[model samples]
Target: MDRRNIQVGDYMAVTSKLPNLVSSTTAIYNNTNCSEIMKTGNPKVEIFLITLLTCVFIFGTIFNSLAVWVFCFKMKKWTETRVFMMSLLFSDCCLLFTLPFRIYTTQHPWPLGDSWCNALLSVYFMNTYMGIAVITLISMDRYVAIKFPIKARTLRSPKKAALACGIIWLVYISIRLYLALGAKWRNGESCFRKDTVMPLKRALYFTVFGSCLPMVILIFCSTQIILTLKKKEKTSMNEEKDIKKSISIVKTNLAIFLFCFLPFSTGNIVRFVIESIGSDCSLIKLINDIYYAAQGLSDLNCCLDSICYYFVAKEFWEKASLFPRFKKQLIKDQTQESSI
Candidate 1:
């Protein structure tokens, strides 16, 4: 496009334009069309969201930050997994840092103004796509390690992983921010809603490419890994143990992301589809409740990330300094007591 057109596009992207004082025009319409759609999200769900987000903030911060430290400071040689892990750590922490803002929004209006609200909401969107891409990469990398060890030795490297990670982050933000910046931001509306101007197709394109595609690829890689392990089951005892461990890891990773993604994505997409196709008040209200609950569950991925990303380290707690020392000291005390 021409510079003039580009300038216009950029201007439209960040413009503040919303309908009123409550989240988005769509939310207003929901309440208008649906019966008490705004009240569909029960009090317990709100309370649960607040509690869950707070826990994610505490644990995700501790674990993701610790992983970043270990990958950057403690490790001398950067492996492919370390590079990917570090990227995932950064992404997790990025979203985790914004949890306090998100938590407040669940209970109160956006007290921080449009800029903070938009920026924080954008961060959450960026996290979902960037994280899904990175997690898929990690899963494929592990599959390569076990299935084709020699090939992995040649193809898998820190530099390549870092390069791939950079691309994922860049592409995701470029796409997501196009939606965020170009979005109509009103004073009283929440930042997460779709504007009338922003077509539903845009959201679908993002979901298909960013979320669905990555998920499909991840499932494929996980399946291949599991099959290969079973095929080679008669390998040495250590190899058998590793195979079981790898299978467990894949299962856990799949469960965490899929569990989070399925609920929110289903509800969110269905709600939009219903809105686009034909307005059904009861359906909209029901889906709204589902969306809110699932959205809260999806946020738990910030915590689940720590389990799949950080604990996968084979070196374990050697450099963690957070776990082993406590265990070792406790064991020492137990030995002393027994001897006495």
Candidate 2:
């Protein structure tokens, strides 16, 4: 029979294989606290989670697919914009790739082995961190482009974008590989790493690398872009164009940083702090659940990125038709110019 079909009582195989510490915890929870707290199952919560995740998965898959298609087939050259956009799509899709497992696991108990369980955890964290890194760079790219156009032209190139993306992924994956191999669920419960000390340490690393560093870079770049635009307000004729450019950069950074990432990271900071302060295990579990829920919210940003693209890049929006349509428009415009 499938693992999903198995009852709580039939959880023998998983429990039997677990280490004694885990087994003891499981038995204690099952006998004493499980009924009082867990209410036998979380089907309602699981249903809601599935519904939310399904929407996220479908939207993320579609938006990223379109972005990749446009980048590969429609776009002419590997410009800096295209390079950053391509990198974003790739990173976004990595999270989308794991959605099926996440969605399934919400309703069903973990179906896979220990290794697969750890792998899922690692992939989710790595992809999320990677995506944040790329978005940060994209904001910086925009800041340079608008604030210092000539300097931007020299610094912003597809090769550099690709190299930066490669480095981000490599560093993220390297730091997280220990999670995949060393991390394990307690009592076969399919959680993160078993060692208690590592959670606080990992959380500190996460705060610095994934959250703090990116936020600093993003804020500095965005602030510069905003200030430079304000300084150029003396040019009354081009004021609208300049404002739009400034707003584009600011909005992109604001959306990803505020709406997508900040909540979860903040919660994580609290979680780590609580762990460091030696909070009760039950409170830690509650906070962790909140963190995961916040993470679900963050994942939706990948799908919503098309909205950012639309608002930020009006040129792309205006000219985004088939090649034949563009060719026809070009010829018509040329003919009109000749007649005039």
Candidate 3:
């Protein structure tokens, strides 16, 4: 009878431990599965991204600073172009302010805590979309100026441009502020490394409104402006050279806009789709690599915005040369030309 009692006690003890043992085993399996699924790191891609961002930081800073100086001090009159350019420059500067942190986080774990991370990310994304919005505005402004020259006088003015920019800033800032405040970060999670998938609805909204809509506006406005200029070129023989130059600038601007932004937007969509469909781990990793590279490319837009400032602005060269250094160079060039 004592032996039977002992055997029954042992069985009960073992049965009590079985649930814990099974749970422990399941936990181990899950950990192993996650380790296998998640990428450790990709050294090559990291190096490339670091290099690209570094170059963008350097060039974007110099160009944007120069542009700000030119627009603020050198250019005396406030025009529609000046207003839009200044707004775009401000957006670029905002993005540039966060680039150092972005580069740092790319290589090392974020040490700035969650609040700082969210703030920087908010500025980063807000300015990125702001840049897009201002560019679209510029294109639309150009189209209006070209398509309806008579109406453009009433339609395009510095005050009106300022109002438009203000609206964009208000909208984007409000949305970003909402998002930044509402974001919930997990414990031990580093910046830009959230484990939770973005909600499908939010992703769809951003992909459509943030990227696709602006791109479509850019295309439509650019096409209309180019066609209008071409028609003018046909009718006006004396200004053929100037019209051709304008067309070339328009094409180059459109090309730069697409080149810098398209890959990143496409990658976002592709990554979202892959994640939604439960793609393989390797495929997700590949998409991540591509997305990172595309993000690097997108950073180049700040540097390239200088191209638009120089070519698209009517008074850029004139105002730029007003600086003592450029003025001296201009004099020297004219002297050499006359001597030749």
Question: How far off is model 3, as Cα RMSD?
Answer: 6.3
Model 1's alpha-carbon lDDT is 0.70
Tell me the whole-model lDDT of each prediction, alpha carbons only. 0.70, 0.68, 0.79
TM-score of each: 0.79, 0.76, 0.84
Please provide, for model 1 over 1-340, each residue's C-alpha lDDT reduced to its tens digit, 9 standing for 90 to 100. 6999999987776564433434677776765645334433457777988888888788877777677777788777777767887888788888887888778767565566777777877788788778888888988887777678779778878898999999888887787678767874443444453323222676567677877888898899888878887787465775566566667777888989899887766766777787676566666556665677787787788788767643466543455556664856543322110000
TM value for model 1? 0.79
Per-residue error at 62 for model 2, in Å? 1.4
Model 2 Cα lDDT, one tens digit per residue, 155-194: 9788998888888878888878866566544334433322
Ranking of candidates on lDDT, top first: 3, 1, 2
Off by over 4 Å in 1: 1-41, 185-187, 193-199, 322-340
For every candidate, C-alpha RMSD to the true structure in Å:
12.2, 11.9, 6.3
- Name the better of 1 and 2 by lDDT: 1
